[model samples]
Structure formats: C-alpha cells, structure tokens
Target: MFEQIIAGIEGRIGGPARKVVVDRGVKPDNARHELGRHNPKVVIPLGREGIEMVAAGNPDVPVIAGAILHPSPSTARFHTTVTLNTDPLLLFGRLKSVAPATKRIIVIHDPNKSEGVIRAANDAAGQLGLDLTVIKVRDRRSAAWMYEAVFSSIDGSKDVVWLPTDTTTVDDTVILPLILEQSWKRSFPVISSTPSHMERGVLLALYPDYSKIGNALGSIAIDAVGGGARNGAVFSRQVQAAVNERTARHLGLKLSDDLRRQFDAVFPALAPLSR
Candidate 1:
C-alpha cells in the first residue's frame, strides 16, 4: 500500500520522492533528517505517530494520509485523510446490482464505532429501495445474540446480511464462523467488507482496490500542493468485488458470464473432470 501510494505521488509530481519512516517514540527531528534542508510541500503520514509529528512540527505543509484510526481534521489549508471505512453507498450499490430482488439489508454494528456508517447505510438503502435494519450491540456477547436473532428471522430471498468493517462487532474468530455456518444452513446471502470472507462461504465481498486508492491519494496531494480546494476526511471509493461461486450456487444465484466479469476474485475454481 505504501509503495503504491509512493508510485502515485511520484507519478503526479514527475520527480523523485523522499520517505520518512515514523514509529513509536520517534521524534520530529527524524522527519527533518530525511527531508534534509528542504521543506516538503506536502507531508503524507503513514500512522498516528506520523500525524502527531506533523501536527507538532510542520503544521504548515499540506497533508494527505491513509490507513489510520480516528483521523482528526487538520487546520491546514489542505488536509485529506483516506479513511479505511467502507463506503456504505458504494457497497449497497453493488448489492443492488447483484441482488436486484433484495428488499431488506440487515446489519449489526457497535453504535459507538459505526454510527457514521449506519447513517450512510440508511440513506443508501433508502435510495436503493431497500429496507435497512440496523441493530446496535455494545459488546461481542450482545453481538452474538443479535446475530442469532437476525439470522433466524430474515427471509432468504428478500433479505441479505451486511458484514461491515467494524472489528468490534464482527469478531473474525468467533462471530464470522457462526455467521457463515448459519448462512449455509439458512441459505441467505451474506455480503462482507473483507474479501477473504467470500472464500469462506460469504456470497459476496467488497474490499479496497489498493492501486486505485494510491492513485487517488496522489491526485489529491497534487491538487492540494497546487493551491486547489481542501478535502477533509475522504472515504475510499475505489473498491474491488469478490464472489464465491459455490456460495452463489447454494444461494440459487444464476450469475451469467457478464456478472462473473464484474468480480475481481472468484473462489473455488472448478477442477478438471477425470479423463
């Protein structure tokens, strides 16, 4: 991800780039050491520490960053943060395309962590003519109970469960397997934000397209450096889709060749028949 972002940065600037490695307990002088005597026009911080360093020392430069938690808005003229949160509008648009008959979208999330995502999902679902049922859970135990309740009641043909990017509510080891197993038994479609979940029996998954994200960051940086408009807290729009053909078969989805072409990855490749 860092490499791609660098490639994009250099591609836009048409020049060599300097990289500053930031880690825990690292001071601001380390950034200055890498930058030497020249002040950078833009600073792209990789982690939370990097952001702190920038805020403490070089608050004047335009900044663009990605893959961090709780990105605070900067007072700089151009501060763009590439959030890792999955865009619910884009996710639901894909769902509407693939599952046209889907009428209800069910999601279980931690209210504290996913209030923004749930609000966006509600708007997206309304626009797509899908009913949105958002169940909030405070802890993993409550999440499990909520999942069981939702799984038992939803109609397979009309309802699809959305697994958001919230790790608090969607514990991989505990909750994921339960959801997948119940989905197989109930024959309901399960869409995930994690791509590998498709291989583990999720009907469909949406994940970041790294190269596209890098390119976008690069473009934003270039524009920012050129005295363009400021962009704050931007969520990634470039996404790739994955589908499990075996799960599709189980869910009675007739995916044509054209539909298959839409997915970046498909699971369980068919083996050759015995000769």
Candidate 2:
C-alpha cells in the first residue's frame, strides 16, 4: 500500500526522492537512523507506529501518514494522515447504490470509545433519509445478550445493522455469528468494516483498498501542500464495498448490474456463505 502511495506521490512531484520504508516502530537506533537519514521533502509514515516514531525522532520533518485506522488525538502539526477506515459519505453513497430502500442503520458500539464514529454515522444516515439506530453496549456482555437486544427491533423489510470497527463490544467470532443468524432469520442486511465480513454472511463490507488510499493520500497532499504539509487528518475518499451474493440472494435482492459495478471487490466468489 505504502509503495503504491509513494509511486502516486512521486508521479505528482517528479523526482527520485521517495521511498516505501519498512517501519521500525520505536526502535531507538533505527528510528534515529531513518528519521535523521532523510532530509527529503516529505516523510510519510505508513502506520501508527511509524507516525509515532517519526514524530518522536524528528518533529521538523513534514510527515504524511497512511494505513492508520483511527486518527490520534494529539497529532503533530507537521504531520498529515490518511486512514484505512471507510469514509462515511462514501459508505452512504455505496449503500444507497446497492440497497436503496435501507431505511434504518443499526450501530452497536461502546459509546465511550466511539462517539465520533457514531456521530458521523448519524449524520450520514440523516442525509440519506435513514434513521441511525444506536445500540450502546456500555459494558461487554455475552453475544447472545447483545443480539437479543439488537434484534428485538430490527425491521426485516427496512432495517439494516451497521457493524462499526469497534472490537471490544462486538468481536467477529462472538458477535458476528449471532448477528448473521438473527439477520438470516429476519432476512435483513448487515454492513461491516472488513472485506472478510462479506464472506461471513454480511451483506456489505466497506473498507479501503490500500493502493487506492495511497493514491488519494498523495493527491490530497499534493493539492493541499506541495512541498510543506501540516498536521491534520485527511479524510480518504478511496473506498471499496464488498458484496455477499448469498446474503443478497437470501434477502430476495437482485443487486442491479449497475449496483454490482459499485463494488470495488466482492468476497467468496465461489465459496458458500458461513452460517
């Protein structure tokens, strides 16, 4: 991913002045060498640890980061970041394309850890004329308990549950099976974060295609700051929606040829959906 991003960045600014570095997080000697070795135009750290190590080692360098899922609270001023997390706007657009009548989106989260994401989802839902239903699991409980509370209100015809990136409240092995089981019975769809979710019976899974993310990050950096970039998280618009044909089939959805075209990738091309 980083390599693709570097290739993209270099495309804009013609030079042999970039590298797709393997991040050595917080290793003092290596960090020093890597951070100090380059007085190049921009330093783009691929992940969170790389971003951190770069900031710690040399705050003066302009750093553009990629593949970090969540933006840090105290991000440095000279560092600009692009994340692998799907943008809410893009998610809404794709959801609209593939399943237009999805009237409600249910989100389960540990509210304390996910206020921002929940708020963004709510905004996205409102804009698309959908209700954003939130199920706050203040504490972790059994998967069955969580499912019962969540499924009690799901309207099979109009409701869809959105699985956020939060793992504390809903781990895949525990919560996904229960959610898929309930949704299967009701015949509603579920949207989630990773592409794997599509194979696991989730109707739609939205994620970043790393190469695409790299392209966007480089483009944003180029447009925003040519030679000198500053800190602030850039919302990456590069997103991929994976569809589960089996789940769609069960719901009686003939995902349109046009709608199918919206997906950047689909999972289980030939494998059966998990129970």
Candidate 3:
C-alpha cells in the first residue's frame, strides 16, 4: 500500500524523483536530514510515526500524513491509504442488510483510545434508527469486567457485539479467545476488524484494499495541490467487506445467495473434497 500510494503520487506529479525514508529502520536525524535536504511541495509520510518524524523534520512543508488522527493548520490531511476505519455507519448498514433482525449493537473500547469512534457510531446509529451501547474500558482488566456486564444474556437475535479495533482492550491474546468463546456460547454474533479474526469466526469484517486506497490517496494529493479540503481530516473512501460464511451459518445469519454475493470477498470457500 505504501509503495502503491507513492507510485500514484509520482505518476501524477512527474518531475524530480521522490526520496523514500524509512524512519522506523533508520535514525530520526538521518530521516530528518534526508527529508530536510529539499523543500518539496508535499511530504508524504507512510505511517503514524512517519508522520511525526516528517512534521518535526520539515515544519514548513505541507504534510499528507498516512495515519495521523486529526488535522491541524500545517497538516493538510491524512493519507488514508491504509488505516483502521473509524466510521460505523457503513458497517451498520451492512449489518442491517445481512442480519435484518439486529437492532442494537454493543461495542467495548478504552475511551482514551477510541472515543471518537464511539461518538461517531452513536450518532450514526441514531440516523440508522438503531440502538448502540458503548462500553468504555480503561485497560485489559477493565475490559474483562465490562465484557461480562454487556454480554450477560445478550440477545443474539437482535443484538451484536462489535469488536472494533482497540489495541488496549481486544488485542490481548487471552481476551480475544475469551470474547470469541463467550459469544459462541451465547450464540451471539460479532463483527471484527482483522482478516484473521474473520477467518476464525467473526461474521463480518472490513479492510482497505491497497489498490482502492491508492486511488483515494491519489485524489487527495491532487485536491491538496489545488487549494485544500474544507474538511481537514477525512475518512478513507475505499473500504472492502469480507464475510465468514462458516460463521454466518453457525449464527444463522440468513442471507440469500445473491445478498452474500454483495461482499467483495467471502472466507472459507467450499472445502475441496478428499479424493
């Protein structure tokens, strides 16, 4: 995705070849020197850390950071080539179509980590005419207690446990297994972020395809060069969906063959028979 994004920009803005800096692998000063050598019109940083390094190194250059959370006066916009999606409306709409009975969703996360996501989800839920329960946890231990509180006697028919991207909470190896196990025990459905989790048992998943992300970033770069986006920070427009057919079957998430076809990809394709 990083290479693709850079290529897209280069292809569009032909001239001097752009210098690539791997701040993670190299020293910060080396990266600064490499970046500071030229006062390029646009500085594209590939990751969260890269964004910080570029900002420090070239304070004057307009930076299109790939993973920074918000926008500032100096910062034009986020690259959006690759990152966890913060919007819930899209997922909610997908859930409504696939699982028609789902009326409410419960999401657990640490407020400091994903407060904006929670707020956005809540607002979107209202617009979608759905109920959203947000469970805020401080850390792994708090997440454990909150999980029990939220999922106790959860109604699988009309309720879903949304496993948003939360490193402080759901990223734990032990906690992940426990969450999956408990949901399975209660016949509850879960929506996950990672492809691995979708393959494991999560009913639905969202990801940004590199090609699609590149196209969006290319447009952003073009727009930035023009004047500026009114909205400083923008969500990535390119999002892809994957479904775990096996999990759907397990959870009885009824969908016609045609509706299932709507997904960009489906996990657990029909297994080949033994010869």
Find the candidate with the highest TM-score and give its number.
Answer: 1
Question: Per-residue lDDT tens digits of candidate 1, residues 130-176?
Answer: 89998988999999999989987879998999998888778878898
Question: Candidate 3 at 132: error in angstroms?
Answer: 1.0
For 100-175, candidate 2 gives per-residue lDDT tens digits of: 8888887778766666677777777888888887777766574347668778876877888887777766677766
Q: Judged by lDDT, which candidate is best? A: 1
Reference-based lDDT, each prediction: 0.76, 0.70, 0.68
Candidate 3's TM-score reads 0.84
> Please, what is the TM-score per model?
0.89, 0.84, 0.84
- Per residue, candidate 3 scores C-alpha lDDT tens digits across 162-234 of 8877787786476777777776677778886656677556788776555555555555666766766434455
lDDT (Cα, 0-100) at 180 in candidate 2: 78
Cα shift from native, residue 254, model 2 (Å): 2.0
Candidate 1: lDDT over CA atoms?
0.76
Model 1 lDDT, residue 249, Cα:
79
Identify the runs in model 3 with alpha carbons over 4 angstroms from their true place.
7-17, 24-33, 68-83, 269-275
Off-target runs (Cα >4 Å) in candidate 2 are 1-33, 74-76, 142-144, 224-231, 266-275
Error of 1 at 47 (Å): 3.0
